[model samples]
Target chain A: MKCWLLILLILFSQSTLSADFAVIVSATSGIDVLSSERIRDIFLKKRRFAQGKRLVPVNLLGSKPPRLAFERRILEMDRLNLQQYWTASHFKGVTPPATQASLASVKLFIEKVDGAIGYLPIEMVDDRVKVIYEF
Target chain B: MSFRLRVIVLMTVLSLAPYIVTMIVMGNVYRDDYERRIRDNMTHELDITNERIEQSFQSLRKDMAFIASLDTMDDLLTGDLDKRITNLLVLKKNDMQLIGWFDVIDTDGNVVASSNPDRIATSADSSGLFSVPIRSSFDDNQLGQLTIHYSFENLDRFLPESEHSHYHLIVEDQQVTGPLNTDPVISVSRVLTDWPAVTVTLEQERQFAFSLLNSAENLFVIVLLVGIFVIASIAFFVATIIVKPILQLSGTAESITQTQDYSQRVAINRNDEIGQLSHSFNLMINGMQDMISRLKAENENRIKLAKEKDRAEMLQDLSTKLSRYLSPQIYESIFSGEQDTTLGSSRKKLTVFFSDIVDFTSTTDQMESEDLTNLLNQYLKEMSDIALRYGATIDKYIGDAIMIFFGDPKTLGVSEDAKACIEMALEMQRRVRELKSEWGAAGYSKPFSIRIGIHTGYCTVGNFGTENRLDYTIIGSAVNLASRIEGQAEPGTVFVSEDTQLLVRDHFSMTPTSTFTPKGFSQPIQLFRVISSGVTRSEIVIEESGFSLKLDSQELTEAGRQDIKTRLLNLIDDL
Candidate 1:
């Protein structure tokens, strides 16, 4: 009975940790929040401008934990589905979001650029950027 | 040296000197030009190789820059997670056949994209053979760099390779491509303008670079040898042609001198100068032969002429001795072909003269035979000289008597001949008187005197003898009468017959004398004594046993008169 309780506690902490990521922008962006659909449209190049300003979107490279969580929870797509969607948008002259090789590069890019948006682990996000969305 | 050898040497030198000189000069020029061309060719090849290498590098840089300028490279701003720049790098590497990999490095020094998949997301530095900086398309800030790991093998395609020559790519003082030649006759290098640390070099081997010059030198030597041989051979042939005749000529001359024979001649076979020389030599020999034969003939003729001259001189000597036995008129007539020498006679009116030495027999009995002969010869010689002066032809000498006549072989008229004979008799008496005094002075008390008789008559005068012996004489009564008249003459008196006296009576004074008849005469002949010429002058005549004289004052020179007076005084003192 104790081993069962311990397994359940481990499972709960793992979920909490997996969900600790955010979509952030520069603090001076004057953007207060974003919805999942709007964030998806901007990342997939369906919406080129937001809040009367052009949006620049950035992503962590490959399948990082934050990138995977953003793709699954906000974009509502698996890794294969998201790649397929970008591939389809590619023929329409639409490109997927820009990518950084590390979470640090993603955080730095959002902090330095206005109208810039990117996903990072909640622990890596700094005060130089504002959190627009969380998953 | 022999003429042929000398000529050959001279001709070889003459023909080959210019050839060798020109060959050397041209060889030098050709070698220089060939070396220059070879170097120029090497340089040109190196230039082409350098240009190709440069062009390749330039094209690579341009492609890199073009790729770097692409917005696809802007993916470097997002770290190129989509592999957009990586895909482009891979494509460029394949298209250019690059042997090295390409990478896109971000400003953070991380390789975001790479042609080599293993290098993706790797940290990289911008150190490579070639690099192009990536800039942000939005603000032109430094983003990343497009870099290539350049392989020297890429330049190997432009490097030319051959057996004797090779090309090398030197990068930062290291040989990158192509084999390094250890010993090169020629080395050409060019540094890359864009890639400053790289150099292109061409190396050529010694054998390959100078092959043409070596072959050309060999050919020149061969040609020079052949030319010398040909020139020497031609010179030898020509020298023989020219010298053979001269040798033959010298030989002929030597033989001729040794043998002293001019009959030898050179054979003429050509019309060149040598042949002309032989012809002239033959002509000279012919002339010599002709002269020798003519001289021999002249010598023989001279010998024969000398023998003939000797014989002619002997005949003349014989004729001269024989002439003493004949009268001058008769000898001249016979020799001149006017008279024939045969026994014959002729009758003609002639004046005949006879002379006899007085007391010759008595004087001969009293003296030696030699003294008697000398006295008789003296008396006859004086009388004969007078007789010849009067144009008398002497018939013969009989002992102490002489018989002569004028007329017949050559004559005046009979009267004129008679007158000449009387005058001759008178002069003979006078000479006899003079000889008496000369004999007294010569120590002979008794000397010779001559009495002459002359007559004018007809006689037979001719040659009378056998064929081997002959005499020219007169035989007739008139000749006997002239002898009988001489027998009546005194020792120093002249007596003439009436016939002679009558013919000379107008020119001389004569008195009738006693007549005498001979045994062979039938009638007595009247004779006369001649005294002097018709011009009468003071004269003297004296005769004695030991003294006699006859003088004509009208004929005496003053000196002669003085001489006579001196002689008379001496004679009177002696008396």
Candidate 2:
């Protein structure tokens, strides 16, 4: 009920925030067309590919509900463990997924970058950014 | 025709004849060659197009066969769901640009898979594509056919590009596609391999052979025409060389024939055959001219002779007219070139005779003028005829008196001349009697009597008077004595001078019949009468009352007396 209430309150505050999110890639990414397991592997930094293309995972703003839902549903891990895993992966020449404060920045990054993978709200997704996976 | 023109025409004909034949032959040959070339080219083109089509079909067949042997094709046919045969076909179709599409057919003639999946279940359209059976390689099993639709764009690229020749495809004896040329053309065809079920045709324009022939004919005509002109010019040049001398010779010949001048000659200096001919022609002309000149001379002589003959005939007519006026002795002397017409007198001894009708003036006065003229002319004509017969040249006649002379222009001798004069006088008297009787019978009854006188003496005998008007005569006292003696003589009597009596004494018996004193002479001359010209014969004379008759009995016959009696009786009855 609290989660439903938070979702409603976030939706009711339409000018500022939203609950739904979208998984996207750069419009020209070879990695845009992929399935669910590959999406999970890309966000956990467990594998660097969907098919044979390089993968990119993007985050929403901190404490966004879509990010937590992505960690629980797609990664099947909590946010702190995912962060710890990414931090530990950095010493091995690995990096965690990047974060963007707004869907617009994420879309901007996706439109400008090649082989980039991210998630945004379904409502925010457009031709500039391609949706590869959804949670 | 002029020599140059003739020769030029001849040479032109001769030179152009062969060239014309050659031109025609070359035109025909060119046409034949072009036709042969076009036919061979068509045959070659047909072969090339058919080979191209065969190669195209073979390549398509190989591709289909390779595709049929593929593992994906086998796996897909055996129901392996993971295998993507249509995608493989898409890659192959893209690789070979001429392949339109491919269909994998099951044995039931159904398309199980295709590059166009929408076309898989629906009936496949294999209208113009090659449908090759895709048999399994391992078992020779009957796999479904693989229908391949070849791109027409690629087939079109195989067509030959030629202006003279074109290529086309014929399938099942029907024209499916053709070369760009649409008009009528010569064509050759060849069927391709049996699998393609098509024929390749090559076509060429109908006028191709003639086009080559046209160019050849133009070239032939140009060359032959030029050759004709050149040969004709040369022939004219040669003809000029030959004809100049011949023309000159002809000119000279024409002039000679026209003017009849034989002296003209044609000059030639060369030694060729024409020069020889000119020389020979000149020789013949010279010979002819010689003959012509000779004939001309002969004709001139004949004309001169003819003129002379005509002039002689005219002179004869003039002399005959003058003989009536002049004495016949004078006329003969003048015409015989013995006497000149100049007025000069000469003395010659001549016997002169004079005779007249007795009392002619009294008798003639009683007669009419016309009857008198007739009587005078008759008397003169009879007396002159006797005179001429006896060789007495008549001198003159004075009003019925006739005077004659001999021994002047021509004479046997003086004696012969006198005797001839006497004989002539006797004959005159006889003819006068006859004429008188004839005149009396014609109604003039005057009894005509004649008196004769003869003389001989030296007299001037020549042309007398002016040179323009002259008379050939004798003029002297003898002439006067003869006339006066005739006046004194009785009718029917003849008398002569003493000179004539002496000269004719041997030939006649003479009587001193009369004497006359002439005015111009101082002495009287005695006139002797001639009694007879020969030995005396019997004679009879009857004279009474102005009627007189004389008869020579030696000349009378019995029959003649009887005739005279009968004539006298007839005359009495008329009286």
Candidate 3:
């Protein structure tokens, strides 16, 4: 019975990745393409602003799929490893990114805030929040 | 205590003092420094281990990203279960330890397909993979799940030798069911975005034993050895410079005191306190030697002078006594003149007198020899004392006789000898009477008397006779005549020649003993008894053949010649 559970965990953990979080802007915004390194730098909170617009990196609720995906793809780390990394980084005076819950909330925050970056499935995205890059 | 012991103690203390100090300081410094160094090394080792562990994870993430971009994971994501299992089996064969599974979960959070389908059968959290409500690039209705559990070793190939691990996969929101012995592991999960199958979860174990042992062992020995070397050398140098000299000076000073010798000194050349002390000690010893030598020399000189003084006093006494035994004229001839005492003879005018005890041998036989000798010596000693008192010299003792003289070695005057001779005769008579009474009291024989004869003329008085044996004697006719007169004299009386009488004619009243013609003499010699009492030099009265003289006072006074002429003239009418 426990073996069946470990296999499920392994399969689920490998599939639902949110490493490629999207950077959203206004549909009529002037910003266009960004390199994979630039997107990584932005999602990892290395670059605070891009092209005179303040970049906001949003996080999913704890233990959520997109949050884990965002950590693994953008920050290139697992949830447990990221927790350890953030704990060690906090000791060095660095804080982790902010978090929110639900795809609806991600879309609402992205439409209202310029240069807002968040992660959701492509179906949940809207005209109000234009996708700047995809994972 | 002895000098050597003191020195030993001082040296030992000096040597040990630094060692003790070194022990104290080294103990303090090494304990703190070693502890601190150990802690710092531990911290640095920990930091390096942490960094290496982080690097291992970073490399694993990059590999996972690359694998996610591979077309293989995408195919595994969308393929049938059999196909995905076959594909993952190939991937697992490539690196079996870390890549535990390759599975796919549908948008309903179900494990639709998997390489290890049995391993994920009970995994309830399909949201850990790409299984939540999310839009695909083609449309908002497309959602998928992709999950990969790489083997522990495959996840991080750059794990250091100290960080090798045996792992157990931990399923999300599910119980771990693998072998428990595969432990001491950390489970890591990554969420993938573009290629859902790129999501990975891994378990790894880290060990830091090698780095800790290296840091602790090597650096401790190096730092400890360096600290000990520096402290030990400092301690030794300090003890030698400060303590060694004190010991040397004290030892040498004590040695010098023991021997009281100035020859040895501490060999110090520096201008320091101990050096000065050594210099002073040398000076003190030198001074002591000088003083001792000076006193010794002076003491020897004093003893020498005392011995010489004793000899000189003895010589002076001998000379004074010898002068009393010899006539003055003879003494001058022997001592003052060049005539050798070992040789013989000198010509001079001298008076000689000889007196003898009558029947002296028979007289001595009646009494003890000591008493008789004492008696005779007593008589002689008294007579000699009188003779010296009268300025006469004792020439020699012949049997019981005494020979006396005057005017030989040195002369007093023309009449001095005659006067001494006369005074000696009077004193002898008085001494003999005293001895007779002393002998009678001792119950001995009747005392004996000394008879003496005197003559004054030229004689030889010196050491004379055979070459082998010599005597200092008067050897002239004058000496023989004096002897003859001594023999003729009656017992208890002194006889003198008319030559002696003429000299004392006014001084003496004497009846002639008789004329004697001896075998060796051609002429008869006349002698007289020196009148001893009740007679004045102014008048002479005597009866010889009924003759008496009453001399006129003027006639006796006019003649200074004992008034013999007046007395004879007054008696001439009867003649």
lDDT of 3 at B207: 27
Compared to the true structure, candidate 1 yields what TM-score?
A: 0.44
State the lDDT of candidate 2 residue by residue for B1-575, as single tens digits: 88779988988887788878777777678667777888897788677776776786788788888887653454333321323567767777777764467787767666767776675765655563767666543234556777776654455677866676666776677676754676678878777664456667777778764675776677777887788778888998888887888888889989988997888888878899878988898899878888888988999999998899899888789889977887677678778988778888888888888888888889878988898888787777877778888888887777778878998788988888888888888777767777877877888888588889888888888877886787778888778888888887778877778887887777776767556677878887787776766646466444334566566766879999789779879977986
Q: Write the per-residue lDDT of candidate 1 for residues B1-575, one digit (tens) a residue.
A: 98889989999988898988888898889878887788899999888888888888888888989998876765676566456788899999999889889988887788889898999878885457778898754445778888998877888888868899988888889887877677746878888887788888888887779887888888988998998888888999999987899889988989999998888899899999888899999998899889989998998999898888888888778879988887777777888877788989889989888888888888888887877777778888888799778877878899989988988677888888888877787788777767877878877766777787887888988888898988888888888888888888876777888888888788887878787677867778888887776646467665555675678897999999999999999999999
Residues A45-112, candidate 2: write the lDDT tens digits: 77776678766566665777666667766677776787788788879966556555555666664664
Q: Across residues B1-575, which tens digit of lDDT does each residue of candidate 3 receive? A: 74444444555556566755766576567656754664465455444544554565465455544444333332222333225334554464356454455445545555545556474444535333122222222112333444555443342443233334322333443424334435444444433233233333333342232345345545655755565565556655655666677778767768877986557766768898767876886687678778878988999999999999999899778878977766554565666654467865678777777889977887777777788778877887888788777777677877688888877554676467776787688668767766777778877755776666767677887777778876677788878888898888876677888777766666666778887865688998887876552246444333222243333344544455466666657767766
C-alpha RMSD over true interface residues, model 1: 5.2
* TM-score for chain A in each prediction: 0.84, 0.74, 0.72
Best by DockQ: 1
For model 2, the chain A TM-score is 0.74
Candidate 3: segments with Cα more than 4 A from true spot: A1-135, B1-268, B299-340, B359-374, B408-411, B440-446, B465-469, B517-519, B533-575
Which residue pairs clash in candidate 1? none
lDDT of each: 0.81, 0.73, 0.60
Give the TM-scores of the predictions, in the order they appear.
0.44, 0.54, 0.39
Please name the candidate that would achieve the greatest TM-score relative to the true structure. 2
What DockQ does predicted model 1 obtain? 0.09
lDDT of 3 by residue, A15-44 (tens): 576323465555555566666567667766
CAPRI verdict (incorrect, acceptable, medium, high) for model 3:
incorrect
